[model samples]
Every structure is written in C-alpha cells, then in structure tokens.
Target: MRVDLFDFDLPADRIALRPASPRDSARMLVVRPDGLADRTMLDLADALRPGDCLVFNDTRVIPAQLEGRRGDAKIGATLHKREGPRDWRAFIRNAKRLRDGDSVDFGAGVSAIASDRGEDGSWRLSFDGDEPVELLLERAGRMPLPPYLAGKRPTDARDAEDYQTMFARKAGAVAAPTASLHFTPRLMERLAAAGIGHETLTLHVGAGTFLPVKADDTDDHRMHAEWGRIDAATAERLNAVKARGGRLIAAGTTSLRLLESAARADGTIAPFEGDTAIFITPGYRFRAIDGLVTNFHLPKSTLFMLVSALMGLETMQAVYAHAIAAQYRFYSYGDGSLLLPA
Candidate 1:
C-alpha cells in the first residue's frame, strides 16, 4: 500500500510537552469498530473485562543519548542495540565526520571507537576501558527523548522519571514504551481490584522507533530489530488466558510486537528470546493480542501502520481525525487510545 495513504494533518500545538499531573488523569480515546468515545486512563479497568490481561513491557530506558567530539568535529550518538559486553550499534549525528576505526572522545574519560558501519548507516561502537558501559553512560549520557519532544524542549531531570514507566526494571531500552508511561501505582491497584490480570515482558525499545518512514510504499520500508524476551512461565500463563476465553490486551506497540513475534500460526505464544524486526502493516493478521492500548503515533509512521493493521485503515483515519479535533495530545509524551476492533 502507498505510505501516503497513512498521512494525516496534525496541528503543532497538539504535541504534549509534559505528562498529565497525575499519570492516570491523561485522556484516553477509545476506538471501537462502531464508533469512538472520550475517556481517561483511569477508565481502563471499566473498558476491559475482568478476564482480560494487560501485557506490559518491563524494559527500562537508558541514558543512550551522547554528545562527543573527535578532534575538532562534534559528534552525537544514540545507542540503539547492544552488540556485546561493551559494543553497541549507534546512530551517529554528523556521521560523515567520523570513519571506521576512528575514536570519538565523549568527555569525562569516556570514549568509543566507531567501526563496521551497517547498511542502514549506523556504526558499531566499542566503548573504551573495562568499567561497565552502563556506568560510563551514567556519567556521560542523557535520556534519549523522542525527537518530536526533544526538538521542542530540552530533556531535563523531570524527564528522567516521567519518561520511565512504573514497571521499568530490566534496563536496556534506549526509548521508553510510551503507552506504559500512563500507568501508575494507583492505576495498578484499581486494575487489580477490578480483576484485570497483568503480565510483563521485555523489549528494549531502540531509537529506530523515532526514525521516519521515507519510503513511498509500505513494502520498501525496513524495520530495525530490537531485543525482547518472554519466559516459559509467562507464555504458559498467556496461553491459559486465551484457553479460558480471556482477551490479551497489549499495553503498547512494543509489547504487541513482541507478543506477535512469539505467537504461532495457531495463536499459541511460545517462549522467545532475541531480536525481532517485525514490521506490521495493513492486511497482516494478528494472532496473539485481542486489543491494544497505545499512544497517538506520527503521520506515516510504522506505528500508525501497525494500528491501521489492527483495526482498519479507514477506521483509524476516522479515529485519528476525532482525536485531533477533540484536542487530544500526540506523540511519546502524549495521550493514549484504546483500540478494540469489533
């Protein structure tokens, strides 16, 4: 399908620079096959049945954004994936200034050597010294905010806490799973009290999520791989939910993609570990998840294409139109939508 088919006009002001004071206070637009309705994140329990399970990504965001210099040239890098104990694949800003085997000093005694530029133009960087790279990042890196928000305002201490979800534990992700940002302790209590079960998996969201689809057609667009994991116990439990006639609700596109990657043609989810570059587009049949709770996405983005595949192209267009006209927020720090196709 033409990528232009997913394009939509969004007013600049609709982008959310900050989250709602109380996380659950953020508005949620419920998109059903028949129509749309306005609601809040707090209403999630009411929107879902008692038997349903909400799947969340437990991957924590790391300080992957780094600024450095090589000689006189300034360089910026966003670490997307872990290649080894000290090696990472990073997308470089001002990449032309550096070359394979060139070392860039990131200040504070931290530096890395760039090597093996990939087909996508990202470079494989091996950090110097024996101290864990995580420690090096702590001293020098900043949270990798989505460009949509970063381009507007600088990342600050507030974003350190706001960009991460309550479920964050296993650290690796360069980007936050935005849909999970709306969750809070109070909301979790309410969900549990309402008998809505919840589970977690890990998908280290990469900076690739922020990349734009420059392709003219969906077929030409390539998705960058991200690491994810699903344990046997979790897979058994998720399968049980389906066996007992319960719906599996993915909390974000990250969770949905990982779940789909682990699911078989027969709809059974298996234990999985490793990278997934699953690119979901229209005409794709979903096997694992019954519904999705996700943030408003960018125009012509792969995320929008995923949602369009989940519901229908026309249905999502209308849903997005309603969201825009209703003044709902957009992007990573934005409002969310509960998409339940009939």
Candidate 2:
C-alpha cells in the first residue's frame, strides 16, 4: 500500500491548541457503516450499548518537555523513557549538533550528561543530581505537546490540566491518552448506570508516539517500544467481562495496543509487564479490542494507519474527510470517534 493511502488534507485551524473548556464537552464525530454522525463527548454513554466494557489506559502524562542549554546551543528535549534513577532516554532537538559528552543544563538547576545513543535515534542521559528526575520534571518540564500544535507554546497554563485526563493520577507518560480525556465523571456514572464496566491499564506514552512513520509501505514500519503492565486482578476482570458476553471497547489506541499485545488467541488476558512494540496494520488479526474510542490522528502517521486497520482504509479516509468538512477539532486535544470493524 502507498504510504499516501492514509494521508488526508487538514486545515490549519483544525489542530487543537487547547482542550475543550469542560474536558468532556469536546465534540465527537461518530463513524459507522451507515455514515458519519455528529455528537458531543458527553454522548458517549448514550452511544455505547449496555454490557460493553471499556478498557482505559490509566498511564498519566508527565511534564516531560524541558529546555536545556548544552554548551552554547539551547535545545528542547523530551524524556522518552527512564533508563535509570539518574539516567534517561530522550529526544533532543537538533540531534546533529549534539555530540557525545555534551551536557544539558535543565532549568531549576538540574543537569544531565549525554552518555550514549540508544537503539533508535534517542540518547541516554545521566543526570548530575540527588533529586529524583521526577522532581526535576515537576519544576522544569512542560507538557510534551505534539509538534503540530500551533499559535502559542505549551506553557500557556491551560495545557497543564487540559492535556491530562480526569482519571490521570499515575505519573509516567509524556503525552495523555487522548481518548480517555473525553470521559467526564458524569459520563462514567451514566455508563455504570447502564451496566457498562471499565478497567484500567497502564502504558506510559513515550516519544515513540511522536515518531513519523517512515516506511514506504506500512508492513516495513518498525514499532517503537513502550513499557506497559496488566495486573492479575485487571486481567481476571477482563476475562470475566468477556465470559459474561460483554464487548471489549478500548478507550484509546494506547490501551488497544497494550491489550492486543498481551492477549492470547483464545481471548485470555494475563498479568503482563514489560516493553511492547506491537505494530498494528491492515490484515493483522486483532486478538483483543473489538471496538475503539479515539481521536482523529495525523495524516500519514502510524496512528492513522492503525485506525485504518481497525476500520477499512477507505472508510477511515472517508470519515476523516467528513470530519474535516464538518469542522471537527483534530489531534491531541481534539474531538473523538468510536469505531467498529467494517
């Protein structure tokens, strides 16, 4: 398939610079076999059927964006993964200029020495401090907003809360699991009243999420690894939900990917902890995640391709065009959609 198959034109204004006023007040564009339907984020409870189970990625977004001056060069960096107490894997701007032995001085007096290049293009950084890197992140880091967001920078204040989900408490991810941001406490109450169930899982969003798909054909695209875990109790709950004839609805791509990665062909979910780099594409068999709630993704990106795999490619593009024509918000803090296989 041509990489362009997943591409679509998006207007500049559609990219959301900030989240909706009331987080769950964001719009929702429902794409079904019949056609595209417009709705609001709060309508999700009404849109989904009873006995459907929701699997949410509870991984919290860390304030991972930081500015550092290495030598005379001022560079922006995002912590991708933790390599150790003082060591980390990070993506830096102007990688060509940053060489080995360079040191980064993060604001609030924290500093790190570039140690080595990791598996991909990211670097290993060993910090020079007694304060845990998490503390430094709280003081020096900003939300690791996507590059596409324009107008104002991430420090605009509202992003600090808007970029996170209502259920966000655990701290690790560089970005919020966007879909989960749509559910309000009221929405959760509605789902519960209808007998819908939800379980939480963790998959810390990383720099891998920001990687542009470079493969000429998606089959050749290598997945970026992300650390995630499925606890025994949650696994048992998922199995019980399935046995009770509930449909599995993954709240975001991250959660869906984690579930698929840990699922057995027999539909059993087990306690799992470690790194996962499962890449979903067209023709891939989905062992888990029968339905998905997610936001519109960037054109020509792996996320767009993943949704294309879940729904047909043609339908995915068509739905996107409809969303654009209808003026729906896009990206991190944008509108959401619920999808079932074609």
> What is the per-residue lDDT of model 1 for residues 1-342, given as tens digits with 9 covering 90 to 100?
999999999999999999987988999999887788899999999999988999999999999999999899999999999999999999999999998899999988899999999999999999999999999999999999999899999999999999999999999999999999999999999999998999999999999999999999999999999999999999999999999999999999999999999999999999999999999999999999999999999899999999999999989998999999999999988999999987
Query: Per-residue lDDT of 1-342 in model 2, one digit per residue for the tens?
Result: 778788888888898877777878889887777787799978877877888899998888888888888778887788988767778799887777788898888878888888688667788888887988788888888888877873345466777777788778778898789999888888888889988899999998887887898888877788878899999999998988888888899999999999998999897887889999988888788877779999999999889989998988889988998899888899888889988664
Error of 2 at 272 (Å): 1.2
Error of 2 at 153 (Å): 3.8
Candidate 2 achieves a global lDDT of 0.85
Task: For model 1, name the residue pairs that clash.
Answer: none
lDDT of each: 0.95, 0.85
Give Cα distance to truth, residue 106, candidate 2, Å.
1.2
